[model samples]
Target chain A: MTEGLSEAGLIAVVCEACGAPRTPIGPGDDAALVIAPPRGRQVVTTDALVEGVPLVEGVHFLRAHPPEALGWKALAVNLSDVAAMGARPSAFVLSAAVPEGLPAAWWGAFARGLAACARAAGAALVGGDTVRSPGPLVLNITAWGWTEGDAVLRRDGGRAGDALMVRGNIGRSTLGLLNWLKLAESGWGVDGAVRDDALAAHLRPAPPLDAGPWALAHGASAGMDLSDGLATDLPRLAAACGLVLEVELAALPVDPVCAGLTPDERAAGGEDYGLAVLVPAEHVGAFIARGFASLGAARQPVGGERPGVLWRRHGAPTELAASAFAHFSGG
Target chain B: MTEGLSEAGLIAVVCEACGAPRTPIGPGDDAALVIAPPRGRQVVTTDALVEGVPLVEGVHFLRAHPPEALGWKALAVNLSDVAAMGARPSAFVLSAAVPEGLPAAWWGAFARGLAACARAAGAALVGGDTVRSPGPLVLNITAWGWTEGDAVLRRDGGRAGDALMVRGNIGRSTLGLLNWLKLAESGWGVDGAVRDDALAAHLRPAPPLDAGPWALAHGASAGMDLSDGLATDLPRLAAACGLVLEVELAALPVDPVCAGLTPDERAAGGEDYGLAVLVPAEHVGAFIARGFASLGAARQPVGGERPGVLWRRHGAPTELAASAFAHFSGG
Candidate 1:
């Protein structure tokens, strides 16, 4: 991290910790080589995490947050996107720009975290870049994978009459995020088990990796990750399939942390790295047989009779309003 | 550039400019898909550029430098690595963190420039990440390529008794960078067409794309781009091959403007982007006959006689001291 330290020296220090022999060509060559499936296409996505964007101090995490958490979340978000496409993640390339005088130990911790998470998620670090900047640290990750089976799930691949389903409880991450922010401001002691669960959900989102491959094999019509909240993202899925998405509020696998929130408010909460998927009625048995996790099979599709998002509460349908996490909409 | 612009809206605007159907899958969904070669390894490398490093104000260019130039150079430097590997550049992903209030028009221009350069280099912009940073703009590119033939050119593939040759003029880019920096500081009027030429050389350098493939076919044992200058880079090449690199002063393809500079100084000016290669003695005739554009065959390599850079001037050889444009060794 010193001014006199060379890039090669920094690379050496980081690579020492990041070494896992994940790929035939990893980090030191002109570029890393990833073997593409001889038959299937590669699914890829990129995401950039800027300081103070989605992670405001009172809303996301404190300034004293660990680099390990940062490293995990940076890759987790992009991996969630790949999971949305129903592709098993293969490898990724990471790039970070950090300010000078940051301790070498910080990079060591980050590299360790990144390598550990990648390995845990069945992914590998094939390539990366690091440089000093006169700016806040920024991390960007590009992840790619191939389909587990023949079909590579697309966001627009669903049809009318598809059953609406989701994996994992909705709005948990949002509840966790809010709690973390509040606690950071209050300096309050823990709220026992419930708050801790919420905090974990917010701090380290576990993208539904198994559900993606399962959807592809079990006949998922269309699917996408709930990143910018269900209300914001589900409509897009409905719009992509030219159908009106009708969500039964009672069917949502609502978490204990979101006990008091209205159904619509829970639907609007962000950071749930879960999938909102469409499955056909005929394959409904197959989908459930494959053990598709949370949010369960309580919801039914509106058969694309109309185009938009509709929430079903007590058999009454209402239009869902527009909403998303305004990461870049603030000054 | 406005504070209230949504990330989606900004992405739409940027994608509009960057879209040209360059790849089968271009910048959407989870990720951009680049078809991998069914055989052969994929060459990859990443580079991150900060605002001030290697290009200081009143040293490299004016504050109002063209966005197109910046975009071109960001990819150009990465493409240089691909070129060094004797691989045809197939795809690349770019990520940038821009400060708030950076005009959308600037993005349009930058995207246009990046697309144009990628097209010119036979590469495609497969994916990218864009976000608002509470800091200066930082650009990072990860580029990968696949080889034309069986041989994958590596920096450490050569032998002690190989011949040393170069692909193009070494000092032009260095001269160009210096002139542009001097002019940026002085605000002096143009020195005819040559100054403009130098500025262009520094701003948008065109690495010899064909030279890499030619080297691979003509039996180049070892090769790498002349990045980080000849003095610093050549020693590394020598160290990689376990031999002393001997460069005849007269054999160096230096620019006329660098006539008065010391050989070591000329060797230290970075960013030439040409290739310094080691060729076997048997393939020397085929190397020149195959039409390598810049540097011709002029000398033979000493068989690991010493272990460093050896420069010959007036029929006398001496060791070149360590010198390079160090971005990290600061005041």
Candidate 2:
């Protein structure tokens, strides 16, 4: 709280709050030294967002979107990466660039959002940098988490005989986005809950924290987050497993909101934020029951051992056109 | 070197290179686990820079400063924080926002700079985020480092009788800047070494890494870096020590190139990148001798216990009329 305290002073206060275990050397030396735990491996990831690229002033969120949401989203997306790895979140560092003369209230809201997300994710906002910019707001969040045992999931771990399963119903978040776009285009303001769900999905996506751990614990062969929409995400999973997945269209769990959408729209829409897992054929049923209980989502097998996606409709499977969603290429 | 690998992929590779030691249970599960080292103490700091703010397009550098230098500078400035703590440098993360269509060379250079600085500082580039922006380049580097001993030197640690000692000559970097400005103003091209030194000092400052450990090891009572002009930095040291620093201007080791400058110009100049220490009276001589040897600078007692900065002109001490540089205040 003191004014003009150098960066070191600020660090001292934050360090006290962190209360990291002591080593032969700690933060005040040339390089900190820590004893690595015997079994756990350090995992790290980074994500960066530019104001106009991934987020346009009007398209990503309303122009009046709160700075807190911006900050929260920045941290949340990176947390999603940790979730994709089936790893726990640990510490995070933020790097932000905002236009000069932005209100201090905005900064405060941003920090508050960061704190809220860090608390919810059980991670610490350990350190970060802020700078002035002449362009759109840009933020990058770097996260570090650890995991022990073979629970670590990678995109390249699925097997040919693996049964495809997902943590939750897909398309809800995508539907939320479509609903917002429709309302915005029609000049009709949607209801608060619909707006909230859509905005929240767009701004503060809920990464499947529990699902990641549960899948890891239950022997998921391969897993990843449904960030780029199922059509795109599934192929990556299949490729990683060194096989092809014949997705049955009838078994695809479409959200009621997405039911009315055209097939192409449903296939290509993104922002799902769900976890997809590959389970051995034998454990499919048990994983469904246990995983649903643990993750609060019905883990349905959406695909078979054959390569490529097959959409099932009216009790019959049909081959789909494309494998995934490309952000720039219209589906 | 491969393209198409996302930021997360790059970090995974680097983490592997650094030897992924077992971390706590958090990282690979849902978040990360960063145990507060045994001591309930930590140090934290952040810094940010926008392209137009600290660096104007053509004015900052010719050939458009490499993205690598930008990245290196971002991290180096923060490393200066760790150095000031007399602490060891540890881990760092970077967040960057660059304009769209920026060459891949820019990204590569930026990453190389980050890696080079991290390696030199003995810290690992653990993670970071990158995104496209419509604005000028923006970079933020957040670094974490620590010390083993609890007696980390602080700005407020100076005492009444502590002898003021500085590592490295002051004003060279400032002189370099003035030369560059002159060249720019006059359209006069300069020698390569002068231009390189000026740009390098401004772009990729070499923080005194060993000085911190030496000061801590030798029992320095108080210390900090000369980021702002000595005149301003000295006042801060005085305020922190709760005593006045009576600096003898004649004895001040101004770089020979800066000797003929006006008093105000000489006093308020910055970018020295030198360490300043307040040695206790009992250890003054030894501290100066050892500090000089370690820092490769000639040491002299600038002033004794006094109320304020005093200058010597023609063998007698005289009070100067001007104050030190204030970065935000534009003094």
TM-score of each: 0.87, 0.72
Q: Give the C-alpha miss distance for residue A262 in model 2, angstroms.
A: 6.5
- Local distance difference test, candidate 1: 0.67
Give the alpha carbon lDDT tens digit for every residue of B1-331 in model 2. Answer: 2255454554454345444333322222222333334342234455666666333422223325555665666677677767776767776655555454556555666566776777788875554545445666666665666666555656666666667787754655565565555566666454322236544665566877777667867877777777766766766666555575656555555455565555545556665667788777677677656644121111223456444454445456565545433321231
Q: Which sections of candidate 1 miss by over 4 Å?
A: A2-6, A20-24, A53-62, A148-150, A186-195, A291-306, A319-331, B1-6, B20-24, B53-63, B186-195, B254-262, B290-306, B321-331
Q: Model 2 chain A, poorest ten-residue lDDT window?
A: A292-301
Q: DockQ, per-model, please?
A: 0.52, 0.27
Tens-digit lDDT string for candidate 1 (A92-146) = 8887776676666666656666766687788877777777666677677888777
Across residues B1-331, which tens digit of lDDT does each residue of candidate 1 receive? Answer: 4354556665665556556343226765555655656676567777777665335421222324567776777788898888788888877888777677777666666676677778888887777777766767777788878886556677777776677877665666666666765765766344322335556666777888778867987789888887767776777777666776667766665567567556656666777788888898898777767654222222334554556666776557755544534421121
Spell out the clash pairs found in candidate 1.
Answer: A30-B44, A31-B44, A31-B45, A44-B30, A44-B31, A45-B30, A45-B31
Model 2 chain B weakest lDDT span, ten residues long: B292-301
Native contacts recovered, each model: 0.67, 0.43
Q: List clash counts for every candidate, in order.
A: 7, 59
